[model samples]
Target: MKPPCYLIVLAFLPSFSFCEIVVKGDGILQDTSLTKNEATPTKPQASKPDPAGDDLILFDNGDVMHGTFGGIQGGLLWERKDIDRPIKFSIPAIRQVVFKGSSGVVMEKETSFITLVSGDRIPGKIVSLDDKSLVVKSSVVGDLKIPREHIKSLSPNPFDGELFYSGPYNSNGWMILDYRKTKEKDKAKEIAGEEKKPKKEVIQENGKVKEESSAWIHSGASFYSLDNRALVYPDANMPDIGRLKFKAKWKGRLNLTLALHSDFTRVLPAEKKEEPKAEEAEEIEDGEKPKAEGEQKPRKKEQPEKQDPAPLQKERLVDFRKNNAFQNIAWINPSKRTHADMFGTGYTMTLYSSYPNLSRNYFSETGVARTQRMASVRSNISLSEGGDAEIEIRYNRKESLMILFINGTYAAQWNDLGGFPGDGTGFGIVNNTSNARVRISEVMITSWNGMTDSANSMIHPDRDLVLLGNGTDRFSGQVIEIKDGVALLKSAYMNAEIPVKDLSKIVLKKSTSTDLDSDDLSEDLTWAKEPMTIIYKPFGKIRLNPISAERNLLSGNSPFFGEITVDLSSAAMLRFTEGSPDLSDWFDDL
Candidate 1:
C-alpha cells in the first residue's frame, strides 16, 4: 500500500488545525505492508517534551504544546491560536502579568506598560512590587502607581536592585526599598500638579466629626469607599472641613466630662506659657507683630457638659415600741360626748332629795298623784332594836322581767306589778315576816334581759336605775352602783354591803317585831300621806308632779307618803327626803 499525498501536505501548516501535529522524518504515514529502515531518517531532530523551566504559554483551547520565548531576553512565551496543545511559560519570563478580568486591558507587546481593568495603561520602570501593591517609575509615565493585588504575577525589575536599596534582612517576607534615587526631568513640578491643595481640616471630637466649624458628619454621609479602592467624595455632599474647640474635666474617678464645639483659635489658661505684660500689650497695639509662642494653645470653649441629675430623697423609717404607755389608752366617756344624748336638755336638780314618813291624807297637797300605769306605796314598821335587816319586796311585771339586785345578788323580782290593787295608796309589805331593821339601798329597773337583742350592746334606752332616800336619821350613808343587769350598795347604820340576787323575795324587815299580824284582815297598813315625787332625768315620774309638796314627807308619819316608785328609765339617781323641798335640808340626801 502507498501513502496519501493530501495527508502529507497538511502536516507542516501550523495555523490550520488544532488537534493533529505533523512529523517529517518519521514513517508514521508510510505503506502498511512495508517496513521503514530504522536508521537515518534525514538526520531527525529530537522531539522530546519541553522542560518544566522552558517557557510555555497556554491558549483558550484544550491544546498542549511547547512554544518559544518572545521578548528581548525571552522574557515572554507565545503560541499560535491554532495550536493543538496547551502552551506553557517559564516563571521568570513574566515581567508583570496583570489579570484584569473579563473586559480588562492586556499589555501591548514589549513596553514596560500594563493596562488596568479599565483599559488605562502606562509604561514605567518598576520601582517596588509586592502582593498588596506596586510602585513603578519610568521616563514615559513617571512614578506609575498600581496595586499588586490587581496583578496576577510579577518578575522583579532588574534596575530596582541597587538604586532602590532593599532595606534590612527579612525572613520569608517582602522587603521595602528606597525609590528616592529614581528621578525624572522636572518631576517635582509634575508631582505638585497632580497633588491637591489643602482645602479644610475635618476632625473628630466627642462622638461627632465636624468641619468648617459648622456641622457634624458621619463616614458614609459624604464619602464612600468604592470597592475598597478609592474614596469617593461627591462634590455636592463634600463635608465642610475646619477645626473645633473642646473643653473637658474629670467629675470624679472613672467619670469624665467632655464638651466639644467650634472656635478653637483662642489661647487657653491650661496651655498659656506666661502672663502678658502691660508694656508688651502696648507695643503689640502699636502695630508690631507679637512674637511666636512656643506651641499652639487650644482654647477652652464653654459647653453643656454631661452631668448626673439630682438624686432622689428617700422616706425615713421609724420604730414604734419606744413611745409612752398613756398614748395607747383609748379613754372615752358618755357624759362628755354631746352628739347622742338620751337625757333631756335640762336636768331637774331638786329631784334627788330624800323623803320620809309618807301619808295618803296629804295626797291632795303633796305631789303624789295616781295613774293607771304607776303608783307607789310604802309600809312602815316600828323597830324596837336598831339592828340590820332587809326589805324584801317582789312587785313583778307580767309583760317584762323585772329584777332588783343588791350588791351583786338577786334580791327581788316583781312579777305582778302590772295589776295595781286599787290604784290605791296602800301600806303593805311586798314581802312578809321580817325581824331586822330596813333601809332602801339601790334599785335597777330593766326590761327582760333575755328578750332584748344581743346585738344591741348598749344599755336599752328604755331602762335605767333610781335611788330615793329619807333623811340621815332614816336612810343615810348608802352607796349605789349599777352596770349591765346588776346593782351594788352598802347601807348606813350597820353599813354592811350585801349581795342581793333574784327578785322573788325583796324584804323590808325590822330588827324587833315580836308578834306577827298573822291572818289579821287589817294588819296591812294604808299610806297616810302622799309619797315623795322623785323627778328623774331619763324617766318621767308617772304618778306625781315634781314641784308639789309631797316631797316634804320624807321624814313624816304616814307609810304611803314615804313610799317611792322608781321609774328606772327616768332618774338614774333619786333622793326623796323630808324637807321644805330643799335637798340641803334632807340630811341623808348627800
Candidate 2:
C-alpha cells in the first residue's frame, strides 16, 4: 500500500466557518470539493432524501425554500426535484434549521431539580455554592438563593434508556469466587501436582516393560466447577465491546475476581494496645532532674495504636510462564467446579497488583506459567486509603487493550490482551471486599469517539446532525423521513423508525465551511422516478419521491452496524401513489 500524497490535519477552523453549510431536514449532504472522505476517520456518505415532509430551509433574510435536498457542496445547499438546474443556497445565510425526527438526546427538556426541606422543588443547575448557602439557576424563575440546610437533595433529570446501569452494587449476574475446600484442594494440587491423575499402569513394548511419564500429573490449582452463573452479563441485550480477544465468548464478563481486592485477601492489622503506666519517675532537664524521694515525673500521653491493612483471603491463582501466560487458567482449570470461560482458551498475561504504589500490573496471559512466573506491578497511589471511588474500565478491541481510569485518572492500560470477541461486547465488575462497596453511576457503550457526548458534559458538535435518541441511548445520523410522527433515522450503525415523541431533538446545525463548488457533486444523486409513501405500518408513514429497494431486504445502513440487511418484517411495510409502479412486478427491475 502506498501512502497518500498529502496528509493534512486541521487543528483549528476559521470563525463561523460552518454558518453557510446547511443540513436540510435530511442529514445527508455530500461535500466532495472540500475535504475528501479520506480526511479523517472515514468521512460519512450521506444518504439521499427519503421524503419525510416538505422540508423548509429557513434563511436569515426571512426566506424559506421547500424542496428535497440534493447535496451540499462548497457550503451551498442544493434543492433538487428532477435535477434540472440545482438551486444552491449559501450555508451562511441560513439562520433557523429544523429537523423532522427525534433529537435522540433530550426527549423532553430536562433539568436537575433541587428539593427543599419546605417541599418545594426547583428545577435547574446548581450554579453556585458556599458554606452557608447555594444558588440554583432555573428557567422558570431567576437564580434561586436558598440556605444549604433548607435543601434536601438534588434529583437528577430522568435520562433516556441510554443509561445501562448504575449503583452501589449489581448482585444480579456476578458470581463470587469462593475458595473454601478449594483452598485445601489447591494446596494439595501444589503438593501432588495434577488436575487429575489416572491410575498408574505398566505396559510391555517389544517384550520390555515401559512406563508412561508422570508429567500428565498437573501441579496447579483450579476453581470449583459450577455452571458459572457469574461469568456472563446480567442483561441479554447489551452493547458488544469490540476490544480484548484471543479467546471466544468473552462477552459481558468483567475480571471481577473478588480475590483481586486486597481487603478480602490480605491480613488485617492487630488492634492498638494501651501502654502500661510508669511506676518509676524519670529525670527531666539536667538542672530540673527530680531528686526528691517518692517524686514522680509527669506522664506523657500515649499515641493511639495504629491499625494494619485489612485482612483478605488468598484465592487468586495464576500460572505465568511463556506466551502461555494463562497461569490463572492453569490454576482455574484444576478446580473441580471452576469452568474456564471461552476467553480462557489461549495465551494470557497475568500481573499482580500492589496498592501501596500507584501503577498497573501488566501481564500476558500466554507468555508462560509457573509457581511464580511473573511479578505484578502495584501502584503506590492507594485506592485503599479512601472510600469508594469512581472507576471506569474501557477496552478498545480495535487496539486489543484494556484501560482503567480511577476517578477519571488513567490508572492502567493492558495492551497484552488480544482482539475482542466482537464489537460492543460489554464487561461487568466484581466486588471482593466483604464490607466495603463500590457503586457505578452510569455506563455508556459508544462506538463513536465521544463526538456527541450528551451526559455529564453536554458538548454538542455543530454539524448537519440529527440525534436518534433511543430509549436506552442515542446515535447521531441523517434523518431520512418523518411521516405520522415516526422518523426513519439512518446512520452507519443502524436504521430504524422512531416515534417523534421519543425524540430528544432533531437539529439542523450551523455550518462554518467555506463555499467551494464541486463539479462531480451531482454524480451521487439518486433521482426518484415515482413518488411513494413508505408505510411504516405500525408507527407512521414516510414519502419518498424516488424510492430505492432491493429484491428481499431494504438496501440501507444500520445505525448499529454498517451496510445491514433491513429485514422486511412487522415494522416495515410499504404503500405507493396512483402512478407508482408495482414493486412486486418490479422485482426484476431491482
Candidate 3:
C-alpha cells in the first residue's frame, strides 16, 4: 500500500546474504551464518587409518581403532602409528579399551566369591563377618570391608571342584564355523551337479594350510560374534558331572543353542550306505546253508574281540522320557539336519525370545538323528533384547539331573532317566539368529558335586529374611543380632539361633531414616557429570568416579564405597556415560 511489493523485497535482499539457512538431517532449518563466523560449512574429518597395534579402542558409534593406550588423567591419551602426536579423547565418547595379551591376577588356591546387591562379584578370602560388615582379603585390592546390607550372597568354596577350563583369555584354541558359507556351498553344488565338490579357499602360513571362515573378534576379556556362527571348544576334558557357567550380552534377540558332551568337532554330512545286490544277498544266504535241518549244532562261546581299552564309561540305567509324561512341543526327526546342528550324541539347550520364553532342552542320540525334546520350561524371567545375563548349567550324571540357574536364581531342572549321552567331552555354542550380535565372556567349566544350588528367596521390604542350605528352606523374622558366626532371629513363634555357615543368604531390614531414595542409594559414582563403570576379569563389575590413572593404578571414589585404588591390569574394561557436552560438540569447536 505504501511502497510497491518489489521495493519491499529489494530492501530485505542485502540482509539475506548475511545469514544462510541450512536444513539438517533432523529437518530443522538452522541459520548457519548467524551462529558461525564463516559462511562455508566445514566438512567432518575422515577417521584416522587403523594401525597395527595390540590395544583396541571402541567408540560409542561402534567405530574401532587400533592404538597404544598411554593412560588416563583428565581424559584418555592414545597413540596411533599414523599420527605423530598422541590424540586425546573425551572419556564420555569412548566405549572401552581392550588390551591384548593381558592376563589378570591368578589365584592359586580356593577362594570365596561374594556377590553384591549391585551385581559386582569380588573374589577373595573372607577375613571376618559380622552384623555390621564383612571383611575380605582380595588378591587385587589387598582387603575390602563391605557393608552387610550390600552383600547378596557368599560362596565359601566357589572353586570346590576340579577346574577343567577357566579361560577364553585369548583366541588360541577356539574354532569359529560359519554356517552361511556351508549353505551357500551346498546351493552351488545343487546347481552345478553333486558329482563336483565345491572348491574351498585355503591359506598357507607358517608352513601350514588353513581354511578361512568367519571368526569371533577377541576383545580383551570378551569374544564377539557379528554373524550367526558356531563357536566350538573341541576336545575339552569335560567331566561326567560338571558345571558350565558363562556371561552373555547381546543386541537384539539372543537365540543361542548350547551343546554339551558333544562328540563331533565339526558338522559332517550323513553317510549313505548302498544296498547289497540281489546275487550277493543270495550267495550270503546260501553260505548260511540252513544250519542243520535236523542235526543239532554244537554251541560255541566266542571270545569277545580284543580291542584297545576305552575310556571310563558309565552305564545308562534309565531312559530319558521313559514314561513320556511331559508333552513334546516340537520333534526333530532323524532325517532332517540343519547346518546349526554341529554336535553328535549330546544335549542341546536352546534359548528363545518368544514368551513363555520357550527355553527347551533336546537330546540327540546320533547327531540330528533321533533327536527328542527331553524337557521344556516357560521361563518367568524375561531376557530382554540388548541386555545381559549370567547363565549357569549344572549337570550331575550320577543324580540324573541337570539344573539351570539364571542370574543366581534357580530357573528349572531336567531329569534324564536314560542317563547321560555321548562319550565326547566337548562343548559348543551356536547363534541361531543371523541378525543378532552376541558377546560372550567368563567361560568356566568345573566338576560338580551332584548338588544343586539353592534358589534365592524374595526379599520382603518389611521383614528380615534368611535362606538356608536347602532349596526351599526360608525364614522371615527380625534379625536380633549376628555374632560369632551365628544369627539370632526374633519371630512371633520363637527366638532361634542359627549358624551362619548353614545359611545360604540373609537380607536385613531397610532403615527408614534415610532421606535418599532406595534406588538412589545404589547409584554409581560420577565425575565431570558422567558415570563410570569398570569391568573386572574372570567376573565382576563396579562403578566409580576415576580420579587419576598412573603407574598402572586407577584411583577412584565410589559412591557406595569410599576412596579406593585398583590395579589397571585387573580391570577388563571401562565404560562411561555421555555428558552434557559430548565429543561431537567438542569436534564442532575445532
RMSD values, in order shown: 64.5, 27.7, 14.9
Model 2 TM-score relative to the real fold: 0.25
**What would the per-residue lDDT of candidate 2 be over residues 1-590, giving only the tens digit for each residue?**
12122111111111224443333222333222111111111112222444433333444433334444333344434444433445555444543222322111222244445544323344455554343555665432346565554444333332332334321111232222222344667688755643343323223445443432111000001011112312222231233331121111111212223111111111112356776544322322334655588767668899889986445322322212122211112222323321122122111222112231111221223322212112223233333322334444444445544454455445555443333422222232332222222222223332322122322232223422444444245555554545554656677878877665555444322232111243533322222343233222111222333223432234332111123223233212232232211111211211
Give the alpha-carbon lDDT of every model.
Answer: 0.23, 0.32, 0.57
Question: By TM-score, who's the top model here?
Answer: 3
Better of 2 and 3 by lDDT: 3
By TM-score: ranked, best first: 3, 2, 1
Q: List clashing residue pairs in candidate 3.
A: 318-417, 318-418, 319-417, 319-418, 320-418
lDDT of 1 by residue, 1-590 (tens): 22245344334433333234322223332211101111112112222324322222222221122333232221122433334432333322222111101111122222233323212233333454333445555332245445432332221211111111111110011111001223455577656754643323223445343321101100100110001011100111101111111111111111111111111011111233688999999888898455577855556788888886434322111111122110111111222221001111111000001211211111111222221211223222322222222221222223323222222223333332333221211111110112211121112111122321111221122221111111011122322332232324345334433221211111111111112233542333332333333222211122221222111121122221222222222121122222211111111211
lDDT of 2 at 586: 16
Q: Which stretches of candidate 3 lie over 4 Å from their true place?
A: 1-53, 79-87, 159-169, 179-220, 223-225, 235-238, 247-254, 265-341, 355-368, 375-390, 406-411, 436-455, 458-528, 577-590
TM-score of each: 0.12, 0.25, 0.61
Q: Write the per-residue lDDT of candidate 3 for residues 1-590, one digit (tens) a residue.
A: 12234334334432332122112212211222111121211121122323445566665544455667777876777665544555566776676776653565465545456777655677776666666787877865668887777676565445433567766655445555423333567677766763353333223445444423233454445566645556766556778878898988777787888877765422334456799999999999788856668888868899889986444332221121122111111112234444224455567777765321212222343333445566644356578986788888888766667778888877767777777765667777777777777778778887765546433445456677766644356688876666666778889888999875666555655542122335674344323354576666565566667888763677787555578877667665665652211122221321
Q: Which ten contiguous residues of candidate 3 have the minimum total lDDT?
A: 324-333
